[model samples]
Target: MRLICPNCGAQYEVPEDVIPQDGRDVQCSNCGDTWFQPSTQMMAEEAEARAATPPPATEAGSVDAAHTREDALQEPPQDAWPSAPEPEPAAAEEHWHEDPDAPAPGTPPAAPPEPEADPAPAKRRLDPEISRVLREEAMREEALRSGRDSLETQPELGLEDLPEDEAARRARQSEERVARMQGLDPAPQAHAAPLDRDRLDPQPGSRRGLLPNIEDVATNAPGETKPATPPPADAPAPPARKRGFSRGFLLVILLMALAILVYSNAAMIAESLPQADPYLSSYVAWVDQWRLWLDAQAQALAAE
Candidate 1:
């Protein structure tokens, strides 16, 4: 029987009897693939026919022949049964196939080839609007790097942009605004009425200080003498003289009175007030010394 390995495509020839009628496990010699080798109906029938055929006729048996016949007639020992033959080596280039209508025994159905993997979808393209925005941003950055001022790149902001009336009104307002701040009203003036020298003191050249008011002035007609103004009864009077003794006269009198009183009461005061004793004694000593000096002068004069 012909056999082929599905994995390595290695072909092999094996005897039919080697495989059992039911099925036998077989391994590929080249690829070592193991599969169940099921026998075909034809091979099973051939095996049965061979078994049914009678054994060849033998001549008169020798002792060894009779023993062999008896051994055959009796069931052969389990060890004596024929073992399955090894598979023959496969040729490299050779291959075999059975008729499609009469499929080979134990042949597995062919597997369909796997579908090829599809290429990864192309990366999604960027939206046009987004790409445009990115480009504009890049341009703006490049402009800044080149040191171009924003005012030059953008629209101008000037008076030219304003309406004529608005521009004129703004200019007038600016002119009205004083450049220098107004100083505080020349150092706040007093709330009282202004003073006039002529009105306050009507009479002139009179050194006597007085505040004669304008009501003192009299209006007279031509050829008529004006009546003299009567002096105000409430006018301020002269200051009275302060009566007091002169400083020199008062001092001299005070010294005389003190000396007379102190001498007259010296002994009595010293006895009654012990604190005054020292002062009184010192004063008495000074008077006595003076008297002695005067007596000595008088004596010298009399001698002269």
Candidate 2:
């Protein structure tokens, strides 16, 4: 049987039994076009039906019938054959078609709506007293921080506030103090002139000069002066030491006095304080035992 592709007019030859009685789909090897091909039996039946039809009376009708026969023999029109049913649309596509707001096919999808920002968390109300305390604490901390920053920023010893000469003198004095603390002698100044020992000596009656006393200079180096220590103030006489019994000694004395009192007034104690009766009886038993032991020792000595 011969099969013709309607799309590209390409033809293929195959066995008659390859197609079913109804029809079978066949593809063109040259153009890759697929179409249904009727079986040889069905084609034969169709041809017989066409032949049985009455002949056309007019010449033009006969000519048209001949052309139709030629067309059927070459390639049948696609409309004459039953077409495959179309596939059903997807559920979502069907819904989209029903919705009026759906965008037309090939149109870009609308941008997704931005998420709404969450509402700001509500501030918790605080007690007036607590708020005031917190505010004051914050202010105090801020003041302390500012004070520390100022202290760090400002020059130590307030050198910026002093005259240049005074500042230099103070710096030198600080250096000297540090050197002394470290048990080091201060370095001599390059600019200072050497001191004249003879001129520096103080006269007997005149007021003391700018230079230190001769004895002090003799004891120490010329450039270095020992820091004068303040006189020791008379310490207040130490608080009078109160002579008193120590806690343990006083406790022992109190215990001895209590024992004597209990022993002398055992009967009165038992009558006055009923709670002391049991303790009094135990103490009396202990005393009696001790006396008996002493009597036994005396007897042993007499026997020896």
* Top lDDT prediction, candidate number: 2
Off by over 4 Å in 1: 1-237, 240-247, 298-304
TM-score between model 1 and native: 0.22
Q: Please give, for residues 228-256, the per-residue lDDT of candidate 2 as tens digits.
A: 99766985766977656686788899998
- Model 1 has an lDDT value of 0.67
lDDT at residue 287 of model 1 (Cα atoms): 85
Candidate 1 per-residue C-alpha lDDT over 44-135 given as tens digits, one digit per residue, 9 for 90 to 100: 68899999987655543465698888888898566667889776657522566556787468988678899999999999999999999999
lDDT of each: 0.67, 0.73
Clashing pairs in 2: none
